[model samples]
Target: MPDTSFPGAWSVDAEGSAPPFEQLRARVLDLVTSGDLPAGFRLPPVRTLAEQLGLAANTVARAYKELEADGIVETHGRGGTLVSAQGDAARRAAQQAAAEYAAKTRSLGITEADALELARTALSLR
Candidate 1:
C-alpha cells in the first residue's frame, strides 16, 4: 500500500478554470520540484487516487500519463509509479518551464525567432 496520504492537502477544484487533470498534474509537479515529494516517492495507483480525490479514474490516469511524459515520474507495471531522480526532475522542470515560456511568448505575439533570442540572452546572463 503506497502512502496515499499525499504530503499536503491536494485537491482538484471542480469549479476552477483548469480541468481536473491539469490541476492534478500541476500539483504533483510542484510537489516534485519543491522536494516535498522526494525522488523515489511512490504515487498511489491511478484508480486509488481518483477514488480518494472523487475524480474519474481516467482523469487521474491522464494526469499520471502527462507526468510520466514529462519525465517527472516513472510507471513500472506492478512496481508502481515513483518520482524520478532529482537531477532528472530538475531537467524536466526546466524543459516544462521553457515550453510554458514559449506558449506565453506566442500568446503575446512574439515571433519564434525573437523568443529563441530572448531565451539565449537570458541563458547568457547566467
Candidate 2:
C-alpha cells in the first residue's frame, strides 16, 4: 500500500527514457486505481508534489491536468484535489491487468521497444 500521507510512493528514474510527467502520471494513476488512494483521497498540491518528487511544478501540473481530464481526480478550488469515486472499479481492474502484463514482460526480460511494439501490434489488431 502506498503511504497515503505523502507522495512517497512515487519516484522518478532519472536515467529512464520516459519523461518525468509521464512517470508521475502513471504513478499517480496506479496508486489511485489500485486503491492505495481511496475515494475522496486528496493529492498534494502541484508545487508540493513537485518538490517532493524533485520535479518542476509544471511537470506535476501537467500530470494533474491529464489525470483530471481522464476523470481520475477532480479539483475543488480551495478544497484541493480529490480522487473521483466513479471510475474506481474499471480503473482498478485495468490497472491490475496492466501490472500483470508488465510483470510477465519483465520476467521475460523484454526490452522497452519490443514491449511497445507488441502493444502497438495489439492495438492495430483491434
Candidate 3:
C-alpha cells in the first residue's frame, strides 16, 4: 500500500554503505518487492519526481533509466510509465535475501550496537 498520491520521500540511511543512487534504487525495488506498487502501476514522471525531490531531473532520470534497462519498468508513450510484471517477484526475492543476510549476521550474536558500528565503518569507507 505505497501512497501513490504523491512523490514519496525516503530518508537516507547514513549508516548504509551503498551510494545514494543505489539506496534510491533499493527503495524503489523494495516498493515493488513489498507489493506496495504492483505490476502495471505507473510511476510518477521523471520531471515530477525530480521536482518533488529537489534533485536535478537528470538524476532522477538516470535512476529511472537504470530501472528501465533492468526490466523493472516500461514506457507507455503518453500513457506514462508502468512497472514490469516480473519485477515485483524479482525485487521481493532480492529484498528477502537482503533481510536474510541481516538475520544471519544478527543470529551470530551480532547486536544492534555492533550492526550500527559496522554500518558506520562502512559509511566512512564509502
lDDT (0 to 1) per candidate: 0.86, 0.79, 0.71
Cα RMSD for predicted model 1: 7.1
Tens-digit lDDT track of model 2 for 12-61:
88887778998887787878867777778888888888887899999988
Better structure of 1 and 3 per TM-score: 1
After superposition, which runs of candidate 1 have C-alpha atoms over 4 Å from their true positions?
Answer: 86-126
TM-scores for candidates 1 onward, in order: 0.71, 0.66, 0.59
Error of 3 at 27 (Å): 1.3
Between candidates 2 and 3, the lDDT winner: 2
lDDT per residue, candidate 3, 1-126, as tens digits? 344433355754546777555666667776877777788888878777766666667776777777777778787887777788978656565678768868987888888888768767865774
- Writing each residue's lDDT as its tens digit, candidate 1 over 1-126 gives 657568868788999878999989988987888878888999999988999999999999999999998889899999998897742665666888999999999999999999999999987652
Q: How many backbone clashes does candidate 1 have?
A: 0
Q: Give the TM-score of candidate 3.
A: 0.59
Please give the lDDT score for candidate 2: 0.79
Question: What is the lDDT, from 0 to 100, of the residue 51 in candidate 1?
Answer: 92
Q: Which clashing pairs does model 1 show?
A: none
Error of 2 at 2 (Å): 15
Better of 1 and 3 by lDDT: 1
